[model samples]
Target chain A: MQMTWREIVTAVHGMLFGGFFLMACFGVLVLLHRSLAAHGGSEVKEHGRRRERIFLILMVLLGWAAVLSGAYVVYPWYRAAVPPGVTNLEMYPQRLLMSDPHTAGWHTLGMEWKEHVAWMAPMLMTMVAWVMMKYEDGSEEHRRLRAMVGGFALAAFLAGGVAAEFGAWINKKAPVTGGRVITLSQDGK
Target chain B: MSSPREAVANGAAGAAVLAASLGCFALGVLAVAGDGWKAVAGLLTFYRPTGPLSGVSTVAILVWLATWFTGNRLWRGKTVALGKVSVAAFVLLALGLLLTFPPFEDLLLGK
Candidate 1:
């Protein structure tokens, strides 16, 4: 089955956002586990440790996938679509957004938000991963590190949330269009 | 059973590493101010320079530190190895950021 560019981009966006949500969920789970392990039943402590280890690993992997996939799609599309003469992104949002130039303003803003926020995910996720690796659960040192890492994870998740929302908003508000063919001559090529 | 001094030192190092990673993220955002979509896209990658290099470095260094702390014999000499790699990667990331700015791009690439 040959999917249109719109279909393909949408599918990719779905995968991208799905990764973000999963990362957020797991990040929160790991953080909650750490909290519960501090002053809870032994069973819950065991459960938190297990969940922290497993979910942290998953969150790290998904964060990497989202970062790479986002870069792979956004970069090439930007280069190919925008012509040389265009000065600003706002000037030619149609090319970047795959929409009519007339109404590409909001979509352009959304893309900007998506790009900036998406960049925050990797650093935060990796830091949390590093903390998990560095410290044993339930120790004095581990608790300190976990608190810091948990904060980073929360921030990363928020950024991912914004990026995903802006991405969805852009896709829906300005659904991708079948690109136009330009000709040099006065008439059809 | 680490002494308080050792714990304090480790915490300091971890905080520094986290700061460097955050610096890289800030660079990504700042680079976008000068260039446009290309800069934005470049800064979003896991590769060297204007993007995730510091984050990558933090991860590598942290992993080595963690393994060392945990008495993992296999990662011996990783400290020196990672330090060298990080120096090179930071240089590249700096260069990448410089090039992303249009003025620098014009100077280096030549319009």
Candidate 2:
């Protein structure tokens, strides 16, 4: 297997960090919902509260990593300026997409929305994690708090889902290619 | 089966929810502003490599954190009207989601 630094970073951003974060969002959302029940999942709560807290912390971290990598590392390469007289725009993913009327919408709609909207997840999730950490005991059944947390979490999920979907499609149409190639394995024949 | 009158104050949690929604709303507003106006776009280009995204996200995060800090401080021990706060939050969150869509942004900008 072989891949460029850009491709690898992009995969790590969209696949690893983003993928795990999405799963974690679902997990935390379920946990929050389950707690809204009568017992607060006390059996699970006893052992799982700490586990849930740790998961939440990790989720927030992954959310940050995904967006930061997407914006700072991969996006710079994706949007790199194509020098004049450069006939081939392969290295410039944004320009490559823009050059074609058919593919321009990917850049305009997919990328534009993803870049901004993806950010909301981490911000909201961080707050969700914080509130859960401080106030998530099973004692009071804080229904109002639980409902709001669930709402915020669901919003974050939708935002991440949008970003991930667009990112996958945009990359499929006009992949962010180039950078130093790394050989994963030589011909083992 | 907790008490009819709960113990913990809802203030801190309420602050967090409110601030997060406000931050989201700010991001939407800033993103639209950046897209609609050349001057705003240039000003928001904090990092050349990342374009305007760098500033938009950074400023929105700052708004979130600052509002969170202020809200936390002001409403730490006391209870808040979370019912009202939650309604506002959902509205803002929905608006944020909508504003990020390019078609919606363009419609509002008359593009």
What lDDT score belongs to each candidate, Candidate 1 first? 0.49, 0.89
Candidate 1 chain B, run of 10 with poorest lDDT: B76-85
Candidate 1: regions farther than 4 A off: A1-6, A16-30, A33-37, A40-51, A82-93, A96-102, A176-189, B1-9, B12-21, B36-111
Q: Show the colliding residue pairs in model 1.
A: B49-B93
lDDT per residue for candidate 1 within A1-189, as digits (tens), equals 244564465456545544555556565656546564665334235666687677667766766666555555533343244567775554233364545665555444555445545655555566566656556445554465455556556656666676677666665654443333333355443
Q: Candidate 2 deviates by what RMSD? A: 2.7
TM-scores for the candidates:
0.56, 0.95
**Candidate 1 vs. true structure, TM-score:** 0.56
Candidate 1 lDDT by residue in tens digits, B33-78: 3344455445434543224333333343454345334433433222
Candidate 2 has a DockQ of 0.77
